[model samples]
Target chain A: MSGTLNEARLMALYHNPSAASELDRAIAQDPAAAALVAEWRRQDAALGALYGPVGQEPVPARLRDIILQAETPANLPRSPWQIAAAAGILITFGASLGFGGSVLVARSGASPSLVADALRAHETYVVEVRHPVEVAGSDAQHLQAWLNKRVGMSFTPPILTDYGYNLLGGRIVPVDQGAAALLMYENAEGARITLYIAAEPGQGETAFRFDQEDGVQSVWWIDGGLGCAVTGDLPREALRAIGTEAYDQILPAET
Target chain B: MAVLDEIEAAIPALRRYAIALLRDRDAADDLVQDALERAVRRRADLRGEGKVLSWLFAILLNLVRDRHRHLTRSAHLVPIEAAADQGLPPAQDGSLALTEVHAAMGRLPLDQRAVLLLVALEGRSLAEAARALGVTEGTAASRLGRARAALRVATGRDRQTGTGGES
Candidate 1:
């Protein structure tokens, strides 16, 4: 059967069922289309049965909490007090700028504010299979150059061969400083991790802060004038070792 | 009566779609929660012409695609064998070839998988699936064909398998 006619036949069975009889008659002229439709129906039935239970299962409590929290006044249309609080926080950061580097500090590690953005980005991008990075890992130099150009910081993709993670690629992200960058890496086991960097000129050095959500672990720190966060699903010890090594390689180069 | 109530009614189906796509319960709920939250945040943007369920499914599908975009190609794994017997049909429903189907579905590519789930499993009309994915009906049809063919090969059940041209 010609490709177009064969497609029309199969499509007739699958989508445009009103025309299925005509297509089936044409498909009967070709056994291939009929067999294909049969198999497709079987597969569809299987898919329906396998996943249908999940919807019937009890909804997880955490999901409800997520919705409830998202609906809270702070996250929804910000209440007047919430808007004023945001203004206060911005003014606080602006005032902190006067302090010398290493003096302007947060409650802990990379500041409390940046942690949320880093976590959110980690959640969003780490699940991507294709187009994970704007520049593919095959061209490490281009990935670095692209991120550097977009983020206005000379950043290098850390070599994590020792830790079993090679550079997958990098992309530019938004931060309070206008631009940030993230380089994702994956190991032989297929576990993905990323290192996020932002220019924190004149900001204080950070004590490493760690966070975990949905089985993924993350660590953030500041070295020199750059604020960095490294996040993944690795064990705390392993993630820290990798984060520390990356810090040694990239941050020290800037100093 | 209310848009949110309408949205609440669709949660089970949305959750089912998410689970079929991700194959993980927590991950599926996470996706469902994200869709619902986005719906609330962008409530003003939804026009009455669009059904709340369709709009919510669109959001869930987008989130799945976003996850697909950042995830590595090597990480696709389906433990269909273990989970195969989890869905035993009631005595009258008859035996189902669910495990084989799931394994095959899991091995298929994401785009194909999405098209198949929306149409074959979810009972979404071809045009509705196309609208949800923001693709033409023909594109949706083409994806479905490829998806079905791919499943046949993956399942090793391509009985009467004439030379396949995926037409």
Candidate 2:
């Protein structure tokens, strides 16, 4: 019970029957130790029985879709006509408004494409009834932690209850630069709003720029290397208030 | 394209590991989905020599660790009783024993539980488990030893007393 049958040797034997030759000989001689090994083997077998079939179960459609979509040619570079069309669309609706005394010095970065992606994500996900978000709002802590790590920024989903919106949940969407976090909220009337955050490396602060396309309104800005946009179908003033509140909460105080 | 196929092939094992870790099928699939997303996004960074399965597991273990830290900080532990019956096989004669073992697994420290699952259930070598866990082989072996010992003690108590202690 005390000598060669230490826990380490026993574990090595458990993992590999041929791991320790001397330990095998010792277990054969020691009945008590041999009994312990037998018990562990039985337990291990039970563990196998309990979990082995989980792998054999069909992989969920969502999981398979992720792999399939990642390989699609849709992510390839856009044609010149496509770029011109996008720019024309943005110019028609984009309105740059200066915030008096609150605007930090502006720096160059890719905000236009980020906004486009965020708006597209909002349109795509907000319409889904069965799966609005990847992680549900009831599991807020897990969702926040996951977004923080994957999106490479620390942020808390702003409390929108004061604005009559409750958190529906959030998902990680891919962007041109990296991953973006999209948080969705719903009001009593079933209207939804989404907040999108992505890293805009080396980007400087800017006043909120409002954009409207196909009746969907958005307020987007860059502060402290992070680009954020709040998109919804609400009126411009209402969306601005919510977006401003989110900006105040999500931006680090020192920044 | 080949990497995507490899990812598809590894899905079953990943699901198995996640289910064993989280118990709840929905939560496990969520974890698998997140891992797959991360893997596809970072696939270009994958070196030629690294095995795709191990790389995927490493990503998953990192996510699991993050979740545990978040849960600990929020003090919102998944209710053991509510989660106990999830994804379990239909009860047979040994159902009680299986339940006892399942409950005991929920009690093991996260690190120990992970080591046990990787080695015992997944049939991984100690070194391979260590690689996936980002730990030294020696550390992984010691964790497995402690996990097995803890499991035995927990299940043994249930057998002797007819009812197991609740956490």
Candidate 3:
């Protein structure tokens, strides 16, 4: 056999050592092919020597956390009005901040027009194949920093990977009063979901309230000083599961 | 939960492939995390039980391609020279050849590097590597051959210096 063909056969044999008998016969016949195979084997060993230890190293804690937390059951349902009443009690104890009017409005469980605003933002962006957001999700740090600066609230975007959604980045949209941060996420199947967060000083903690408009489903709630909503064209239960996770991760603990 | 246990078992190998592919530990872990999260979320869609490793590798390769595309579009591609400087270990006696091979790998095109690492470092047959990469088996073998040849030249082990088997 020609040298080039022999090298090709030796290379194949080197990659698939399970076909060792062919390689052995070739090596016995052609010393040059044998040397080439030996060299390739050395290269393979070098590769293993360099990278095999990486696999042997201890898996990181965060990796372990991912597996352990993958299946945490969603939070139990709560009556929205009752949770609003509890929020009202909590807000009453705090020294009346100037923003109490909006807080009181939120407590009555009136669907904040913010839900409509969020849905509009979701509807507008989710249809765009390109430039879905002002900033792309790949530059997440800059996206968060930019949104935080523009929206006037310091917050990190919730990781929705557990729900099969990944951040597609976000943008700041003008709301009824001020700018709101609209963060978008998408699943492998191309379904899109969005979270809208705007500053609502002294809004207190309120349970999730579901809203549906023109085929869009949203669950909006107020926690601490942030009024947030998650909107998507998903079923109520699926949207709630994602909203609950986002709420838990984004909500600041009581101080 | 059972699938999760299987996924956990695959983490080390996934991390190894990521590290070999990206040559950055933090970036490697990040890629692996994305892959694991994806695998866990989509475990129900996985057909058959024995294909988890290849499935996870496929997920990781997709992420790597996505990341490369993003970096390219953003004009933030890290120079291979910089990557070699940052990724290589300190040279030691009897380890110079390994270090050279590692540096040369960084110089390789990402597709070639990926194929080489899958077949050589990961010990995947060319056909299995092709399946993971979503490419035809012939294309994968050719890429593997080109990758090995490039590495041979880059590491100064070309035919001129050593084996005179091929013209």
Candidate 4:
């Protein structure tokens, strides 16, 4: 086997078929080339065997936690859209309501406890793989009816396509207040926003309320005695937009 | 997220690749974190869910390259020796041959190392490896050849010596 052909064959071993055949001819002609190819394969195998287990090693939780952290001042968006919205909200509430602006804030005014429960469920289920929802979006009608019955009213699966999210599915999860209907929507990127809704026995119609904690944002509201919350780790404005979209599209309540 | 679980599922693999690239466990985790943060931040741009892994790898590789360039700019070459000292995992304890194999890999030039790791160690096909590395199949193939050849020298297990002899 000519040394040139052997080199080509050696290179071909890592490439497509045409180059692989050249190794066959080279091996027949040159014993050295055959031995070299054999040794190279052994090295390749050794390296793979040595490093393969790295994949099996438990991933450090810190890696995932980093995603949830509201990045430091250096990493925070310098001019987020939420800044403007926050200013607007600030002007409205802090004017005559300066006595207890913090307490009078929309987020704390609505069912704060229920909003926390909804955020928990969103975080818990958003990362789920095999069973995020009991009934997928394929059976949207059944899912709607089932959830509506479970929660004692129609839980309108919000239309979010205009905001780049399509309904993935929904489920029912127990909340501190009562059983809540959880509907998950996904955008093209697999980023999901979960909406949790349940009948509020004593709560009445309320205004949009935004809550931010640990980089997860959830907008909670009460509409006609129904509590609704949309949660995700999205830009503030985006989450507000989703919350508003879902608010406008929610199924009407029974008088 | 529709494919959020799927992306999350690939974390272990990404961590492994990061470990191979960065050598130190803490550094690797940091690199993975940065990659995930960037991916999550830019989630809206990820239209093709099927390419998520490749997309993540591309982002990871970009971060690695940026860090390396920054380090190099500061006059520090990549800490190849750190990986050499880390050696193989505990399971490979007492396996000097495997330790040498791991060290030999660390000694590989970054280009060749990436190509070899993607194709040979990580089991990516040539096309997929090329896609991940942003190179042509021919370039990836050639780099792989050079990497294997370099390993043969670094490990001193060439044609005559490496003849079914490393037990």
lDDT of 2 at A74: 35
Per-residue alpha-carbon lDDT of candidate 4 for residues A148-243, written as tens digits (9 for 90 to 100): 755656557878889888888987775443356889988999989899887776677887787765567778889866789889988878888888
**DockQ for each numbered candidate:** 0.25, 0.28, 0.31, 0.31
Off by over 4 Å in 4: A4-9, A12-33, A66-255, B47-49, B70-96, B159-167
lDDT (Cα) of model 4: 0.69
Error of 2 at A7 (Å): 1.9
Q: In Å, what is the interface RMSD of model 2?
A: 4.6
> Is 1 or 2 the stronger prediction by lDDT?
2
The candidate, 1 or 4, that scores higher on lDDT is: 4
TM-scores vs. true structure, each candidate: 0.49, 0.53, 0.53, 0.49
Off by over 4 Å in 2: A17-26, A82-255, B48-50, B70-77, B81-96, B157-167
lDDT of 3 by residue, B10-127 (tens): 9999999988777778888999999998998899999888888989999999998888644323322434453344354554443327667777777677788788899888888877
TM-score for chain A, prediction 3? 0.56
- CA error at residue A9 for candidate 3, angstroms: 3.0
Docking quality tier of candidate 1? Answer: acceptable
Candidate 1 displacement at residue B140 in angstroms: 2.6
Q: Per-residue lDDT for A92-121 in model 1, tens only?
A: 544543532223233344475565566556
For model 2, the docking class works out as: acceptable
Residue A205 Cα positional deviation in candidate 1, in Å, after optimal superposition: 47
**Tens-digit lDDT string for candidate 4 (B1-167):** 55555567778888877777655678778888888888877877888757888888888888877785443243224455554454545433222277666666666667677777776666666677777878887787888877877777766655454344434
